[model samples]
Target chain A: MAAQTKPVLHGYFRSSCSWRVRIAFALKGIEFEQVPVNLIKDGGQQLTEQYKALNPMQQVPAVEIDGITLSQSLAVIQYIDETRPGPRLLPGDPKARAQVRMISDLIASGVQPLQNLYVLQKIGAEKLQWAQHFIDRGFQALEPILKQTSGKYCVGDEISMADICLVPQVYNAERFKVDLRQYPTIKRLNKTLLEIEAFKVSHPSQQPDTPADLRA
Target chain B: MAAQTKPVLHGYFRSSCSWRVRIAFALKGIEFEQVPVNLIKDGGQQLTEQYKALNPMQQVPAVEIDGITLSQSLAVIQYIDETRPGPRLLPGDPKARAQVRMISDLIASGVQPLQNLYVLQKIGAEKLQWAQHFIDRGFQALEPILKQTSGKYCVGDEISMADICLVPQVYNAERFKVDLRQYPTIKRLNKTLLEIEAFKVSHPSQQPDTPADLRA
Candidate 1:
């Protein structure tokens, strides 16, 4: 794995899940070749036969490196962290690593999956309402943990994988017009997170992989 | 922390989530005292003043140990694993830890959040449809990963946190009328998981925390 040898990220530009992985890679400052898989414009480029071969479940953000294709955003990021040493995303201690993993799970398993874009797309007639409903619930569930656990960052000042999960979920919240004022801790964390160059360069607007028309 | 000492678990008997923690405690052969924070019949006692003091969010499965109170199921479980060394719930390697966390997430974040009792209670006339829809989507998301990684257990031979997340989500699926026949891997995993005495004792039906009405 040479520094110049970037991994191929099979993902879409607007997907919030994809944004999470993008932020992790940027935070770690790893170079990756973007293999854009448009989720909507082409009826989901992720549904193609070739993509299915890469991920049998047909999901986005599958990464290919060293001839090994890996699925799942968190797993891919952890693999990158293990293979390459940089800014540590997890605590060196086992208990702290578990804490980081727990915080990451609160977003990954708790908040993010509920208001997922596909779920938004699947709910047709009252799509907007259902999407907003889940978004509100996810924000509500996540707020408590954010209040108690965060200190400058998600789990203290040093950035960990949990921060990576939080940034994209917060971005999704803003995208859907979910007022995050109620969650003061979240707002503060997001504010500070936005100040970091790692989150800035990986912001959805800055990605070169996104379609020009979709780039707001 | 004596093995015979009574550890208090703040949970509702009717709460499937509480059952997960309870099962974990019992499976480890750790004796714990049960404190009922009735979530439903008592106007959600979990949301009462006492519980709010324990958990700002007022969710179940909060554990009080060594004069410290911790919320979030994964955090509580991790605390248990760190403080009490019994059968190791996690692997020793970082790569393996990542995989276990990823699989646990597939169940915890992907499956559990959607069918969470509170979420279902909030759903309207289209309840059954949404429940079944989400359960189907969760299983669809998990199948590929399960097919790829599962051995005698979710990862290889030993039971990890992944098993904890899986059993509860599968139980919730059946509660929502999601047919298990569609997911052969999950069905097989559950079949094997149920055989373990720990899982059997942890079964919601067998828990003191499970309310009479909800008991199978």
Candidate 2:
């Protein structure tokens, strides 16, 4: 709660939601500590009572900041943007801001949740196929949207929260073997976004908890 | 686009996402026209090319307002709250706003998407079981958070976006047969919320396209 206390991000190395928060922090130049709650270790540490106390949803990337803990990456990102001085994660124009939220929600809700660890685990042996199916379907819808919305980034020339959402989801898409060529706008935007310092530092491979073998 | 032109909402009667937008409109005292994009009739009208153009995501509750169209119910709701003069759907304080968004995203992304029509159709014969599993999981997590956050609604006494999201999802939970008694906070909030005119007018059973048998 003290102003001098650094924010602590409790997250997993490869979780897309965690990566989103990392990108927001890096973009905002807000120094934060990492406390990895490995999703796969010891039958998922996130499910433990300790972590659940931090986030009743028991999800990764529960951030302790501004005197309270916040989960849901978008909420944390918006909080950072609201309280900190940096590039605006949401654009000034109401229409543009709405577009950004629309795109972010499409990926966050419509796409990512279907292929996430818990859902895929419940999907059993058909996990790969299941992930592939949903990712492909999502990207098919997303392609045209990005085509309509993108200008150097997911919204416009400025890097907004939509761009923050884009890179991680495209990473998940590739991991699931979703063909990127099918979504030219998304692929181009992801490529452009990855070149930024904020995105590079926050990437899954570069995280503090990223396994050595997977390090950039 | 004109100032005098009424906002038009393209949505299905029973879709939970659509219902969220409806509640927001009702709460704002904004009179809007409904252009029903029936999700089930004629093989999912939302999949049609015309609707896809309105919302590249091919989802419901795309609102045509202020010379632009917005998809994703939360995005539309936020835009309305920002542009209109009425009861604020999002509280003004930063932390409280983030909490509202967190709760909204928890349901919108984490729970509802898993058991939505498209997902359920893909889930085949196990759809009922799958819906129950995710709803139960989501409600279990939501209960404690609501207990922590709720005063008279999902956030505080104000009818924020989290409350807009809560009613529709609880309706879906009942349809899927999740036991309400287990989630006392959610049940209590939903009960109190349902008594409000905003929620009553926006109920699925009272929608313009609600089938006669299902009408309130």
Candidate 3:
């Protein structure tokens, strides 16, 4: 995908939530300028007064699109899928959409929120363990559901919003060193999703702002 | 609403998430049988093998609707609004729906997950403070957005899914003793939402399984 000035995305390279939006944009073939918000350097640029004015939550990737700045990764993904031209991220059938959303919400609210950086920070020295615990629990629940719904993608053969949500979360789970071998379905899906061009381009290492030492 | 056998909702009386669905059901005037899943007694009925078979996540409310059991509160709510006969829970315009979803996500992923009973149990002694901290942070972000979009509702007088997510969260906040005085917008919205029949009927205290002494 070529870079253009359609939307400005403020994000950190390693943030799973930010990566979710990046993957969506890549899949949609939408050109966006990446404005790196260094989450580590000088204590997170997202916390700055300027960024706070952009997003009161002080989270990333807050995107400037459709003449407004939007926050929350899932909402941003839905907005992009709705307003922009894309292979539809959500399924057309309401029941299929519900199934897709079920997986998406499983990750968004059930998995990612409990194990994100902010929650890890709050968990203190046991952050890694805390992350692994939640990821394992979420994956255990997700594996059975995915087994029921998945084909080549999370829901049937199509790459829907569920896949968009799943890949990044699996990235974070691996980062936390949560063993995926136990979750065969998730492991298989993650491996398959990582091979996709959209997922490849949106990888944290591939981000323009990814540090040299962290580059994969 | 007349009692009918369309959906069976397995939910705890006090769960904010379950309350969100209850409010949606009430607003949509869909009659669902409530099968109480006691989260406290017998070490949480949701953890039992039978309940886990129904919903591997072991969370309430696990709803049996449209011939399949659905878990995850947001997904269930979306499914209800989408598949059933009801007033629309989301807005018509894409941008409007995005705004509504943004607020809903802020509360769902940002506020509720961090402060839910499971996490509170994990937080141990400092659970109350942790709950208050997150609720305050979320309400701070929410107050401004609500200020922009709200007029008798979370988004321009129509009770979108954001309002469904909000009313129950405010209930949880008050339970945690989080001061709402600082968030006048949230406080006012909560007050107004409470007066509505749907929100009133869905209050935790009014649920069929709510303990008699706890009944309001």
Candidate 4:
């Protein structure tokens, strides 16, 4: 679990999705080398021939383990939990696992996609507007789910995949200047997660590759 | 689980999302009343206050189960799978479950959100054009995963959540004039799933609530 022997994480410094996986690795005390892929610089280093070999989608946070490169942030992190020894990210039960996944999909699919750089770039100057629009809509749907599922973290006291999904989403939403005021359950749970160093240390602003202007 | 004692399902005749759940419920042989909610009438009957009370999001396929209503198409379906005793909708181990979920999320979150009615309305006439655009994007992402995961069904020989998710999305994509030649796996899988009566019976064209123009 020491820092030096960590597996390599090929990711963008400011990618919230990457941050989510980083947080999970941190929480599990799994050592990982942070290999930066600057998404915006030079029109995305992720799209280079070498990186594309790692991810066909040319997406970030693709991890290399046992010489096998895995894509998709959630899938990669779940693979880590499944293969590695540490605290389990997903719960043991089917229903609880479903709950963890529902939250993960909510953030990963619902909230995160709407604000992703590609999506933002697609919509043009209306990026900020679309970002807020989807964030609130996503959080609105997520708020009640959080209330029903959360205790201390996203689903009871012990951290699971749900918290891994939550913190990065809140971070991205704030980056887009979305008003998180409407979702109290989200706000409360996020505040609790913030207290954990695992969450803070994995934040995009704290990443070594983050640009000076974007640093928190 | 006779028809009379079963729960009620409020959905449109042609909403592929509803059709997917209907097929699931039918395969489980859990009877239910199909109360159609017209999506195009008066700007969507789902917007009505009574419907909103049943589902805050005011979307269809809301199930009134044991007097407690539930929303979100996937959540509703998962609840059914958990409570019912019939054939399981999702097959395989936790890893398989995650795979099925990833595929479902790829479509449900990744594809459906982009081609939503509200999204179409927001963007106007160019909407239909982008519908195929997003569907193609989704199917492209899905083909490889399904190819890797398939054994006859999405995760194996038995039909799982991946099948449920796939049927609807493919249905919509075909309806939008998207060519499925490149998505051979999805096309082959859809052809196989069609052999089952559960899926056949739930086709949007057969629904009482389906709009005449949209029906196949």
**How high is the DockQ of candidate 1?**
0.37
Give one digit per residue, the lDDT tens place, for model 4 in A111-193.
77667887678778788888888888778778887787799989887798789888888887887888888889999999999
- Please give each candidate's TM-score: 0.86, 0.98, 0.97, 0.85
Error of 1 at B198 (Å): 1.1
For model 4, name the residue pairs that clash: A6-A31
Query: Poorest 10 consecutive residues of model 1 chain B by lDDT?
Result: B1-10
How good is the docking of model 3, by CAPRI class? medium
- Residue-by-residue lDDT tens digits, candidate 3, A1-216: 444458889998999989999999999998899999998789878889999877899888799987788899889999999888869999898878988988999899999989877778888999989999999999999999999999999999999999999998988887889988889999899899999999999999988999999898
How large is the C-alpha RMSD of every model relative to the true structure? 3.2, 1.5, 2.3, 3.7
The order of the candidates by DockQ, greatest first, is 2, 3, 1, 4
Better of 1 and 2 by DockQ: 2
Question: Local distance difference test, per candidate?
Answer: 0.74, 0.91, 0.90, 0.78
| Candidate 1 residue-wise lDDT, A30-124, digit = tens | 87888888777678778888887776556687788655676678777777787676898876765556557666766776667767766666556
**Model 1's chain B TM-score?**
0.91
Go through the candidates in order and give the clash count of each.
3, 0, 0, 1
* TM-score between candidate 1 and the true structure: 0.86
Where does candidate 4 chain A have its weakest 10-residue lDDT segment?
Answer: A1-10
Misplaced by over 4 Å in model 3 are A1-5, B1-5
User: Which pairs clash in model 2?
Assistant: none
Candidate 4 lDDT, B14-131, residue by residue in tens:
7767787788887898778888888898989988988866655566667777655655567667777876788887664656765776677667767887787767776677888878
Judging by TM-score against the true structure, name the best candidate.
2
Candidate 1 residue lDDT tens string, B1-216: 334556789886646567778767866788788887877766788777777777655578777766656656766776677667678786776666666766765566666777776666767677788889877876886877777778988878888877877888887788788988879999999889988988887787766766678676
Which pairs of residues collide in candidate 3?
none
